[model samples]
Target chain A: MAIQDIRNYTGQITQENPQIRIRLNEELHPRWAHCDMISRYLGHLTGTLDLEKLEKSEVAELGDSVNYVANELLENAIKERSGGSIEICSGAKGHTVTLVVSNRIEAAKSEKFKASLQKLFDGESSLEEKFFATMEHNEAHPEAKVSGLGFLTMMIHHGADLSWRFESGEPAHPGRVSVSARLTASVF
Target chain B: MNEGNHSTAGPETDPVVSGPEYLVRFSRATGTVTFGGTLRLNSYDEIKSMVRAAVEAIGPTGVLTLDVRQLKLLNSSGINLFAGVALSARSSGTKLRLMTSSEYSWQSKMLGTLRKLMPTIEGA
Candidate 1:
């Protein structure tokens, strides 16, 4: 396959200036627990921002959203990656908090991912409908592995602006996929 | 896993499924399954059997109330599991009631989605 660099953006495009970047390599065999720990840590770190003016509930909500988004992104990376390190970058600029997670995936899987994204971005069904439909389908089919609900939850419930970058056709690393989720600070 | 039976007047003991970060307790007397702590299991399969067992314990009659007020976090896999449980309860002609905490904004949204899946489900 020829080298292909595909970028798809949804919602709003913001500047790429991340405040914190954490990389987890597959070689170290990162456990599932790490996802929870890292997400909680990020939540605590993000919760401290603008703490004086915000209500306690608002602060908690902000932390929860950050934690949830970060965990979902990290979990997806760990589950889908074929190999290589997973890089996660998070930062807040103005009213938006951006989280980008990148990992190496199999070329074949990238095609499937693209198709899924098409459904998310281009399909006639609203995101709410698609989310419930996906859940119903998964329930009907017990053997089906992927629910595709994580992305939907982030988009529909958390109001996350999501985008993707797929890079392939490289000699050293063939397939790399990066997912960025931008959440408005006030949405929480 | 530590099992703690709820102190209730019944011959049947309540079922408690617990991990380091999470606890799921099903009280037979009240027909309520209370979930607490964070549930971010890597796969739905990890939680499938436990949740299914709770449903089975609920039997085929009366309403099943899932109290998640104390639940701190429920990942997508956990959502899927709960969705499946809701579907099962609906198909079995059992009323389902979800009690969620307003402290977590996501709970309301999640309840809305579950209601869409099974409109008969009651959210409190």
Candidate 2:
């Protein structure tokens, strides 16, 4: 769905509010091309928002962080979804831009994803260290594409706060995951 | 973005994996490579191989300058790939320099961290 339509669902927030959401159903099956389009659109939108609210000097950094975080979140959602749609949301509160990307995943993979997130929280290794470790691991196993570095990048490289929520399966919806990331960028 | 354009003439895999998301150009004479477009996890191996090859080509006491003003989006894996390249260059006694533009917010933010990782490297 278009971002404008999602905005309607989100209700009428003040223009000063930096948050916005875009949702796509499974029928869209947004391929990589679609992902590129959506990312670019959000990047531009977020960049404009930042420019309007923050100093001109901070625009580049803000734009880059939101775009990078949004793209990675969308990529993961599409990769994990078995057969469902995805939702992407973004907004700024104070000096941080909060972004959320969610989708329905396979029941089997939810545990694995959850375990990885837990590792991020409990593991002693730093985000930078974990990033390198994953890089090395990926070399030996070339087939693996999801190296679990998306959240780390947001946290360490891009200076973004990250979180996730996995909803329990219900009669209507099963295996839903919402991944959220927040970055310290003044949009208001 | 052209796929399968990696040249095998260098010591390692071609560092410039030009694809739909991004384009990489290496100037052998200037020891510089320019990157443009989106870089994701799938491009990680190709980039690593390319950096390795570049370092080997430059050898010890050589310099490799990276121009990333045009590279719009780079995922975490791509960041890791560049880190690997920087570390590899540092260990091999090669100097790495990055040229970035203030016009692009991501480059200014990211390249700064990368320069910190490779302290010996230069550029904004």
Candidate 3:
């Protein structure tokens, strides 16, 4: 909410730089549209391109497409990038679409989940196999299910074709799992 | 080696494709299709059949209620099917009440956005 207030303030500061204000606003709230709901407000803040000027219909489609792709990557990222909470970063922007899902997994936990997660992302194993294996692992502990397909629309159907990946220890010293994708009118 | 083509798809992904587990009639006066078990992608086909059957059973003159409380997850395909059905019902002059959380802010928001995007779609 504070971030939204900042955008309003920025617009009031300089009418000549409304575009700048829009850019600032985009950075705080990244594009996220999934099944009529945005899982993350993104607090995207701003971007180089000006999507703020786009119509809601256009934004809705772009948001849906962006979300579809992001969710698929996250499915695998959760298993591979274990040990920390996953969060969508607020600093992503694009006229087409943008998503940055970040997960924080402590380094102290087991990395065994990493290999299985990689297999799923790589397509060596099916989602079903991964789910069973993950479920077995979850039998001992609960709430781990959040890491798998919690918000699916963003991952599998982003834009047109789907893509995903995983990374750790970025920006901060703590481990992080991140996945992102985009879609343009020409590409779809 | 393969489990053959007979393998049932996971019901978790697409609710539209999944088949219904059963059909229960609360009353002949007012028919309701209650989605039991897990309503996932793999189960949608059956569910669709059930929906059609329930609607037909109730006939054009009767009303229907879709209870989604037990629904595990309603995916994109499921939502589309719902929109399609709701539109069809509207044109047919049949009333369908969503016996669900209209007051639930998130669900309402979701439904409202969906209705806006798909103008033909309608519901309670």
**Pick by DockQ: which candidate is best?**
1
Per residue, candidate 2 scores C-alpha lDDT tens digits across B56-105 of 88888888888888876676667766766777777788988888887666
Give lDDT: candidate 3, residue B28.
40
Using lDDT as the yardstick, the better of models 1 and 3 is: 1
Q: How large is the C-alpha RMSD of every model relative to the true structure?
A: 4.2, 6.2, 15.6
Q: In what order do the candidates fall by lDDT, top score first?
A: 1, 2, 3
Deviation of model 2 at A115, angstroms:
1.0
lDDT of 1 by residue, A1-188 (tens): 44343344653322255677888887677657778888888888875543335556666776788899999988888888877788887776655667788888887788888887777767588888788888889889988877788998998888888888777745456588888888765634
Distance (Å) between predicted and true CA of A92, model 3? 6.8
Q: State the lDDT at A96 in candidate 2.
A: 64
Among the numbered candidates, top lDDT falls to 1
Q: Each model: TM-score of chain B?
A: 0.83, 0.81, 0.57
How are the candidates ranked when ordered by DockQ, highest leading? 1, 2, 3
Q: In candidate 3 chain A, where is summed lDDT lowest over 10 consecutive residues?
A: A1-10
Model 3 clash number: 46
For B44-81, candidate 1 gives per-residue lDDT tens digits of 45456655766777767878899999998888878888
CAPRI class of candidate 3: incorrect
Fnat across every predicted model, in order: 0.56, 0.47, 0.03
In the predicted model 1, the residue pairs found to clash are none
lDDT of 2 at B22: 72
TM-score of model 3 vs. true structure? 0.35
